[model samples]
Target chain A: MSLINIFSDYTLRTVALGSALLGAISGVIGTYTVLRKQSLVGDAVSHAALPGIGIAFLLTGSKNIEWLLLGAFISGWLSLYIVNSIIKNSKVKYDSALGMILSVFFGLGLVILTYIQKIPDSNQAGLEGFLFGQASTLLKRDVIVMSIVGGAIIIIIALLWKEFKLLSFDPEFCQVSGFPKEKLDLILTTLIVIAIVTGLQTVGVVLMSDMIIAPAVSARQWTDKLSVMVILSSIFGGLSGVIGTIISSSTRNLPTGPVIVVIISAISIISLFIAPGRGIIWRRMRDKKNKKRLNRNIILNSIYNLNIEGNRIQGYSLEDLSISKGDFNFPINTIEKELEKLETLDLVKGKDEKWYITEKGINEIEDFRGRLEE
Target chain B: MNVQIEIQLIAIVVALACSTLGVFLILRKMAMMADAIGHTILFGIVVAFFITHDLNSPLLIIGAALTGTLTVFLVESINKTKLVSEDSSIGLIFPLLFSIGVILISLYAGDVHLDTDAVLLGEIAFAPFNRFVVNGVDIGPSSLYIMGAILIMNIVYVSVFYKELKISTFDPNLAMALGISPGIMHYSLMTLVSLTAVGAFDAVGAILVVAFMVGPPTAAYLLTDDLKDMIFLSGIIGTISVVLGYWTARIFDVAIAGMMAVMVGAIFLLIFLFAPDRGLLSIMRRKKRQKYDFAQISFLMHVINHEGAKDEREELGINTIHEHLGWNKEFVKDIFNNLYKSNLVYIEDDIIRITDKGRDLAISNAEEIVNGI
Candidate 1:
């Protein structure tokens, strides 16, 4: 398949559109989840939704995405509620609750699915698509349903932006200011559930969390403001959706969810390393530069002290500096390099093998000491 | 032994192995790490398999366990950078690794015996068919022996280092002060988790291993305060789930591992709701009882404080006392009635007076409150 085929092909277009919409919705909701440190809650909810899907199929005897998703939404919401209750009611830790609920619900789901498999009906064939997601099987109608639901979620988020922002950043203040913190939390959690449910067809249960987490994490590296972060995260998510779709479609034996996960992970890693201000690479580079400047100053200050101690203006060898430095493990080569750098700054002048501190170097030391005292 | 008995034995051993270590994982708040390791170890097995080209090689278990510890190291490193929170760090690392594992399995589906379904939902029913043989003499199923050995290993490890593990888990700083390296204990525990996960994977699959590990221990945590009791109770819970889950699956003709997981959840829900002291129902009941007790104590203290004072008539009048206490009239009346029935306070000439017993109780309660106990 070629690039143009992605648009011209009907199935590919619907799949791409569905994946992109799913990505954008999850990305927007993910910003709040990640900021609130509820990232793994998405993981638990997605896994917990599996049993609901299986039960829905069992009860309805049909594979209608709507009914299945409704079931998914209920159970996913229920799982989050139970998790919250566990934390509030017992000594069980958050991670333990999350892991236990996630696995047990998923286990129940497998039981239902297997029971369905023994039902002797071929309709159960495609139901397993929810496990790893069959993005290629997404129909036009499914995309339309996703769009309408996704549009409603986006609207709700816009209307509740202030409350949601306050809830995410400072729930105590949100409570103190007369907002119903519990109700707001329920609404936020519901929205997160809907986002995970919408993307389940494309990303599946096992890997759906990356859809909610990676985009926000990547976008977070690029900006500090919530609005920009939200927009950037959605864009990263939507772009990965399209790109992953095209790549997966063009290849053989590639699942769209994992491929997209790999791509977004790449983006997150890149952002972590190269983004300005918070980027690891930039921080490391800045630290290196600061250390170099500090080393240069230390060498300059030492030469000034040696001159004052000798009570004479004289050149000194590298050995003299090393002797004065005592047990400080500044390597001999590093000291030599600092002296050469000082000579270039005109802070020191070296003739033959001995180095002498210039007047500028002496004044620099005095100024540093004056600033320190002040 | 028959196939049914063999499968149940394998599951029982797997559950025991998981729940033994699960107590520490939950206590240390690293239960999700078990979930992460459960998934990421698949990547380790795949890499090791690709190298050894043998499914039963000991190197696979070693490699997978190493990968599990590596997952912890990576998550902690990302957490150290403070670029992402710990939960997101976990959420990020495992999927990427698991996805790679899945993609690899799919890409080489012909060469590898592993399938994505088996990775997520294992086929434990087939365990009996893979019989272990030595010198042409058939022993029990290979997984039965494998899981049995792992269970013994876990028991030995926990019993030998029970003190160290207990101290380190409850208070890492104290453990450090006592010259026990929390880091070593953590890594060693993670290594065992990985080993147990790999062994259990052949029986319960990657995902359900988390159920076996977290569900029983968490439910047991609700039922017991003692660490030793919690560990023992979780193992018992795991055993019950395995036996019941096996029979339930047999009757319903469904997946055994999945039913076992469901059983674990069901048992947990029961304990969560109905455990004697720490359960939700009891906690709510305690809260209600404490509310009335606190209100009655405050009422008695008020009467004692105003006894024979100049404002006693004005302050201790039942109708106006509600106003002073800022409580609803009906609630105040209810508390007053209860206090009068208990002989703690009596109304005479419309002024409430505290009895000697009530005065003693009120003074001691006030002292306790003042002492911050």
Candidate 2:
């Protein structure tokens, strides 16, 4: 591809659209999944869809995407039901339930697929691709289906937005307040199952949840507002899809799904280091600046202690601590810098490199170390 | 019929192992770890295949188990950082590796028979076909043996370290204070889980592995409060559900693993709705009974207290009396009839009378009833 080819309707409307839709929806739903701590529910349910598709292929011997998808839906729903049952009935937390179902169902799928492979059957084409996915192979029809599913997800999420927000934030409260938590939970889960089943072919269950969660997670780092989070997540998701398909289509055997995940990971890394609030870079810088202030304050307080004892504080060496501590070379240098800073403020005086605390420095030190009170 | 029997045998062992691992996984809140690890093991398997050049080689299990268990370490390590939350870290790691595994298997080892599809959904019917035999006399399934050895190993490990596992799982801080390294315990658990998944992978693959791990333990968890009981119940539930799921697969002509998982779900739902004390229906039944008994006694007490006449008024107010009783009005009439027939009360134009026995019982044992003693 040339640039013109890349932008052409043929390339833009088929693979790009499907991946983008799948990625964006995953991004949106993934936010809640991540925050509510049900992120693996996506992966688990998606994996669960495998056996359903396999069995469908076995029984129907028909390669209709719809039939396979119906199988995917049943199995996916069944997996979710199992997870819910585990969570509701047992002391096993939701994460464990999600994990358990994810492995067992996918394991069962593998067992089935292995058997299918041995039986000399050709009906399981594209079933294995669902373990990951090939976005480059996504068709215009697949794009249409994905977009419709994505649209339905958006609308349902909108309708249940309030209840979902409440339930996600405080399910116990939702239950105590009588907001039909069980039905709401069921509906929310159903929507997720539907989404997983729909995406089984188009995105493959393997990379889909990462597509869903990565954008939302990266978006969360960029913004505190929910709407902004959703919008940013969708954009990141769509952007990842577009970029992932381009990269994969450029090289044969390059997977669209994992590449999509890698792109999202890059964005998340950027936001984690550079975004405000909890961003690493911001905190590092803030800590550095705070350290300078702390050093100055500590040195000034030490000088004030000498003054309170009515000593000249002129014969002091820098090495001093009530407890065993690190070496004094760095501390001495830190003290010199603070002394200079205090001198500029007229809070300290130096005679031949021996420093004494002025009244102002004493007062400042007293203020920095607040009065102890009961 | 023979295939179904063999599948059931495999499923039972697999379910037992999965459920055994699941009890710990759920307790540790790392259920998705099993799922993520299962998929990621494809990469390990393929890598092992490259090195060992045999899909069935023990090296594959070693490499795959190492990778699966390390996947846990990776998830936890990533989670410790601020960049990715716990779930996000989990979501990110496995699929990337899994996708790599899938793509590589397709490109590098397409003919190796251990592709992504085989890792996701496996057939239990074919499990028996891959036999480990000595001198042409078949001794059932090879996978069954692996699962059995693992089940015994895990049962022994869990049994020997039951208190430690419980302590670490329930309160790691306390466990640490008591000289147990919670991290080590967790790692051991992860190792066991990965080991179990790899063994089961040969027989049932990943999806059913998760179902077996999660379903029975959860059902059992709901039915019992005791840890030992929960373990036994979960094992029983896992075995029963596998048989039932395999049976359903036969009846419906559907996939065995899928049917098995659905069967587990059905059992869980059944337990959810009707498991004697913990089921929703049981809870409802208990509530109904409580309401009935409360109303019966309250009506009996009302008759006793109002036998002559209310000190403040000629007739007792039902609302006032109910307010004092704090019971639903719906049960009052039914309780009144039962009281009347039992001679606990006789109503003459609603001026109720409490027999002497009713008065004595109400006064003497009111506190005991309130306390449910």
Interface RMSD per candidate (angstroms): 0.8, 4.1
Model 2: chain B TM-score relative to the native chain B: 0.82
Candidate 2 docking category? Answer: acceptable
- Every candidate's lDDT: 0.90, 0.74
True-contact fraction for model 2?
Answer: 0.51
lDDT of 2 by residue, A301-334 (tens): 6656655655565534455422114232354666
**Position A33, candidate 1: lDDT:** 98
Residue B346 displacement (Å), model 2: 1.8
Model 1 lDDT tens row, A70-173: 98998899998889889998988899999999999999999998999999854798878898888999999899999998899889999999999999999999
Residue B104 error for model 2, in Å?
Answer: 2.7
- The TM-score values for the models, in the order shown, are 0.94, 0.81
Model 1 segments more than 4 A misplaced: A120-122, A307-317, A325-333, A352-354, A366-374, B51-54, B305-334
Top candidate (DockQ): 1
The positional error of residue B10 in candidate 1, measured at the CA in angstroms, is 1.0
